[model samples]
Target: MSKELEKQGWVKRTTIDEPRLSEIVSEYKSLGYEVHLEPVHLEDVDAQCKKCYENQSDKIKTVYVRKRKQA
Candidate 1:
């Protein structure tokens, strides 16, 4: 997580496979959270999964969510 995001109260949720990203994002929004997505970097991948990610065309992303402030 970046310092800026943390300062703004964003919390790391989970890394989701590309196919399910939209579904999870919608779920978070429906529950009143603001969603942020960042691409999963090679360094962040586990040793066993690194090869899989590199060989596949699909992407993985880290999800961040922050509660919406009351108006």
Candidate 2:
């Protein structure tokens, strides 16, 4: 599992994996960066990809992950 944040107008990237993802989010938030996370299902993969591309192009960063769905 991994999480990435794309800041507005930044071409470079920062990647974080499980355990670290949570830590990074907290760190970024403490630094005053707005952060969000959404559970992504396999069925919604395409939509999620599109969203990441569009939003990221506009300076919004996103993290992609394949997590087991909760029962």
Candidate 3:
């Protein structure tokens, strides 16, 4: 999975020890998309984005922009 991302210049095949992150990468690869897992701190505002993405909710399905400042 990581190899495919590297091939597409989306991400480098470096050591990723996190199991969940690796799983996400593998899933995206299986779907034929080049993706790199972006590290997110749970305490930050982007954590909400991560949660929304995980839940697959329609509320967050529309175009949403993340603010630079953490709320």
The window of 10 residues in a row where model 1 has the poorest summed lDDT is: 51-60
* Candidate that would win on lDDT: 1
RMSD of each: 1.9, 13.9, 14.9
What are the clash counts of all predictions, listed in order?
0, 2, 0
Each prediction's TM-score against the native? 0.81, 0.33, 0.31
Candidate 2 per-residue C-alpha lDDT over 1-71 given as tens digits, one digit per residue, 9 for 90 to 100: 23243333222224334566677667766665555554433343466565554433433234432222346
Total clashes for model 2: 2
TM-score of 1: 0.81
What's the CA error at residue 22 for candidate 3, in Å?
0.3
Residue clash pairs of candidate 2? 6-61, 8-59
- Preferred candidate (lDDT higher): 1 or 2: 1
- What's the residue-level lDDT of 21 in candidate 3? 53
Error of 3 at 20 (Å): 0.9
Best by TM-score: 1
Identify the runs in model 2 with alpha carbons over 4 angstroms from their true place.
Answer: 1-13, 36-71
Evaluate model 1: give its lDDT.
0.84
